[model samples]
Target: MKAEGGTTCGNSTKNDSTEEVKNQYHYPLTLPNYTKAEGGTTWKDKEQVFDKAPKRIMANTRPAAELLLHLGLGDKIVGVGADFGAPDKTVEKEYSKLNILSDKYVGKEVVLGTNPDLVFGRGGLFDNSDGRVGTVDTLNEMGINTYVLESSVTGGTYTSIYKDIKNLGKIFNVQDKAENFIKELKGRQEFISTKLSSIKEEKTFAYLHITDPKELNVEPAHDETFFNDVFKMVKLDNVFKNETGEVSVETLINANPDVLIIPDWNTYDGSSANKMKEALYANPKLSSMKAIKNKQIYAVDFNYMFGYSYNAIDGMDILAKEMYPDLFK
Candidate 1:
């Protein structure tokens, strides 16, 4: 399938923090206050130094859950959660595809129901205001290990994916697993690089983060960011380089990106992509844009594109394949 664009929602703010839905739970708990770190706030690991792999694990996103499965720890995941926007079926299907037997527990109440020992999630997972899962520190205080994905909290490049795996390996007492996983991941990158090297005539693209039909945000192109770095590797010029937030239709029409990237988040309704495409098609200002003109609009999953994980390599691969079909064949 043709994939389009990159993503950069920018540094998250306290006001925009995710709100955890409170569900009924029967678990012992102690919550903690939020503390600010250097660049962002962090939950200090109250129960550091895990002697072995956590038998009961909880990961809140598809990519995180997939990463654990990649490390051959699917059995360790006792509970999983899907994005709030995901359907009930997708929640099960995503995990079952990984051969993991876990339930979708989105809010804190559902999470506590599973009684996980270690939780793997982005900072967004802990909506302290709702006091559902409480804060990350709260879980830690309760003797539950919490490791938030750095990419979500602190931003990172492609290399950070390896670090995530390596860190998990260290915590799980499976350094060898981490190393082997990285080796395979390196092989994936090498293969893509081989494909990328043979390519010429790379096209410029724009990833659109559209929260509403009328408003849009283009991923930061040519910035010192993971999204920029990946596009650089694939040799795609970003039409909206260094741009962010509320890209006007006139500006988007003027920039004229070769391709348009749409995410699963905004398109969660299943019909959203089509609605967006139709809207763009009907707009006199956007109809003539190169992306729309050439049918270069592509829909993609959020985790593989915006997320910082080994899974992101798939995003890179998808971009490369679309840019140079001959390289893939």
Candidate 2:
């Protein structure tokens, strides 16, 4: 498990946005060409409406900040919190300039301190059970709007990401920027589609995470997440797509996937990928697996695989090249 170079692909797109996918609305939505408002409901099934674009916003996660910055709404973001992963290099400089409200999750008091009109982030940020950054309803009651990423609410898919981009564009009145970004993503997808079209067989891969170099967790394919959709885009099959929650090592070895897809948590803990891979390699039970024997394991950026952001396209591109390097070259 050696560190690999990052992709040279600049903001290319993924699988087509033709599918009819509904976006998760943490913020209010206005129907097109309607002068009067009829109000709207959120993914949480709560009522919310917006009369104008949010000013003095707060990005609650790294991907949220990156999306806002890419939309040219960086100035609108008053502060950021809960940034657990590294920001992509494209937005790294601008992201570094923003006021960090907190390194981990922000408390409700800290959120109110920013005096933001809206708090934008994935769905996880709204959990108020622990009372850190109150629930979406409480935030709305406090006169602040909230937006959850659609992908977070309704499984991770390219169509969902596209819908989110379009929705965010309309919400922030940055339709042009959002449309351009979507188009770029589509272009990249088309490039991948063309390059890999010659291949007829789909390779099987397992998206996994390892903590303590012993316990391995597999992401289910049928789950509402990005792995399955991205795997399909690259013409790969998920071995654990049918199973749910913590499949045993024996189950993984029994399934015997063609490739092992691990999230590179190196940023959080140095040499984590190497440690995990080393343990897997040293294990006697896993040696018979094709991925282990052929050394077909890939450690990808955690943000690219886990979050419901536009950056998933980068993750898709990385997978495409990794499995089919000859075609890419």
lDDT of 1 by residue, 1-329 (tens): 11112223552332233211111121123222232332334444333445344678877766677778766677778766764332223234545644332333366766767788887865555655432344665676677777766555444577867777777776665577799989988998999888777566777778777655566666554433566555666776667666645566667767787888777554244556667766766666577787877777776666666555566777677767866788799
Clashing pairs in 2: 13-185, 221-241
Cα lDDT of model 2 by residue, 46-84, tens digit: 544666778898887778888888888887889888776
Which ten-residue region of model 2 has the weakest summed lDDT?
32-41
TM-score of each: 0.70, 0.82
RMSD of each: 13.3, 10.7
| Predicted structure with the largest TM-score when compared to the true one | 2
> lDDT value for candidate 2?
0.72
- Model 1 pairs whose backbones collide: 4-261
Q: Give the Å error, residue 20, model 2.
A: 34
